[model samples]
Target chain A: MPSRSLWVPFELGRPLGVPDDADFQIGVLKSLLGLFNRKSGPVIEDYPIESPVTAETDAAWSCTIPLPPLPDTTTPAEALKQALLQEVGSLAPWHAESMRRMGRTSFGLSGLTPESMPEVAAFLADVASGENPEPLSGLSEPLPIAIRYMADDAKAYYMEAANEQPGSDSPGGTRMWTWIYHETRMGQVFYDLRDRLASEYADRMAANGGERPPGPPPINPISARFAVRPEPTAP
Target chain B: MVRLKDLPKEYAEGLLNLPIPDYGPAPWTDAPDLKDARVAIISTAGIHRASDEKFAGGAADYRLIPGDLDFAELTMSHVSVNFDRSGFQQDPNLVFPLERLRELEASGEIGSVARWHYSFMGATDPSRMDETAPRVAKLLKEDGVNAVILIPV
Candidate 1:
């Protein structure tokens, strides 16, 4: 079977929409479900369009997978990674076309190597934390604009710094911020954020590098990889 | 002082008099009828379970948690949700309001809840988004869900 079926869009770990706000979050969840309503093979469509830059609206997206017997989380996760990397590479050409439509000028595939995953992850940390750091060098065009590294601990802590200040005294913003801060406090986000850097051995490199995994199988899950802090009692 | 672009006739008559909340979506339409339909949620603020092994502060996942927003709860937020995983927790208000939804579901205002709902962290990326999003759709299809309520938390 396929190493992985589909992927979800949000952050790396957080799968659902939000932790609490069931209504709007569920709306997003339903959007994901809308994907499977397709009667045929896997179909892709965009929805809930409120803006022109719809895809990058930073809104989360999801898909569904029927649960019969999932491979052990570890095996599937590993296989899924290979699948994801293949998907990433597969879309490169399409992304090039998209860049052309978006008025982008250049793309540097070499810059997206494992060596670049940490930098991209750092840039994501910066962007999520309101840093808006510069893009990785050599990327003349903004195709795909993502990097992947192996799973580790330190990277985990920084990746979770994705917090915004709470407003209106509502608990939503504060609760998520608390979660990320808690991750940072636990130092796990940092570790996962740079996992590939930790395991950059020569053997780690896939022969295809820019292609899908071999043997139609071979995946690993970064299981329970996120580090959570103890919740404090609210007075 | 009304300019052509800021004409009042084109806007609401009581626009100036309308009291807007400082945060959250401004309600224009009546509340959605949660009858005989599944209500799914999508929070932009990254959310994830601390228990998931392949967690990251990016890539939103839409795993549903049952009975989180009941009335008996004091302030049941998805605090345990992992932001390091979804990053959508950047706006927790978007992610952990299950306690609130559970409250609504209990009042009988909402019809039978779906067996599953969804979540995913928020981040920026343009290419291959559809590829990343299919997992949520697969879950909903399997759960037999119909309606979804997207929360930009």
Candidate 2:
């Protein structure tokens, strides 16, 4: 049990309410911080307010801009890589703008410059083709982390492109990401790479006496030890 | 307002499958008065300064975020897309709440905010916490922090 904590009812990412809504955000913070006064161990308090966003409303959100089409199914791997390069080239300016607005970015892994996305695409294509892709120099992180950053870069490219329209916001970026990850050909390639890497890592771990390597698990949002089991159903 | 009961069936079912860590009994600790306590935030939000090394493979590594840094200077890089980033994207305070902490300090709600807060990639395997948490506790104690709020995403 945690010594002290507050459970905010917001979705996984947003512990507070809406961004830019200072009053609500502060209220939630104050309530959590107030836990300090309790002279006790293992306090778990729930934030009084509820989350304002819902799956129904979140699902209804969309980006106004359309993403570029995936390369033709029959396109050669080199051509596909070139197409991805073109997409990143077009999206670079917008990616920079988005980063500027956020005042930072999560990109820095793999040491692969934004211009090296073609190589990333080629790597994914190789993985998809059942060929083992060689790791790039200075890219010593686990394969999953490398792929995640590549996918993130792709998501950023698409998001910035969609944000070109006025009034575009985070939901718009979310929608763009959903489309890119679930609907595009490159997305499929990414999925394959992730699957292959995860299985390979699991095999390696198994061979190493089932000891996990020094990294996060393939999936996250690790649950607490306690769970609320449903009551037995009436016969 | 959204509640766990209100989650979609698929999501609710998925949550049911997670392995709950056995934290055993709740070990209670006396806390200082709110107005006299030096508070710090420990978030599993995977946040770090732009110039800091990115967390790799759910590494047990943590980043020390100076309490006074601008919210815009922090960024989330964890691989899990399970959580919604929209709110975080708009206002990092929704997850980190550093700005709000500063406000509380200014208003005397808390004695003071720690010079440094901490963050870890939230999706990390729970086993790693055994080694990491104690180290962080030592650092917080050394920094004179009397209260901590663990925000798990």
Assess every candidate by TM-score: 0.30, 0.73
Candidate 2 per-residue lDDT, tens place, B12-117, comes to 7767786777767765667788888898988888888866887765688889999888765676676565545545655678778888888888998888999999
User: What TM-score should be assigned to candidate 1?
Assistant: 0.30
Return the top candidate by DockQ.
2
Q: For residues A62-181, write the lDDT of model 1, one tens digit per residue.
A: 111111222334553333333333333433344444334433211222234333444443454443333335666764234222333222222222222222111222122223333334
lDDT of 2 at B137: 90
- Report, for every candidate in turn, its global Cα lDDT versus the true structure: 0.36, 0.65
lDDT of residue B22 for candidate 2? 76
**Sliding window of 10 residues with minimal summed lDDT for model 2 chain A:** A220-229
Query: What C-alpha lDDT, on a 0 to 100 scale, does residue B125 get in candidate 2?
Result: 76
- Give the runs in model 2 whose Cα sits over 4 Å from its true position: A1-4, A38-43, A70-86, A113-145, A156-165, A172-177, A183-186, A192-235, B1-14, B17-30, B50-61, B70-90, B125-128
Docking class of 1: incorrect
Q: Give stretches of model 1 more than 4 Å off.
A: A1-235, B1-33, B54-94
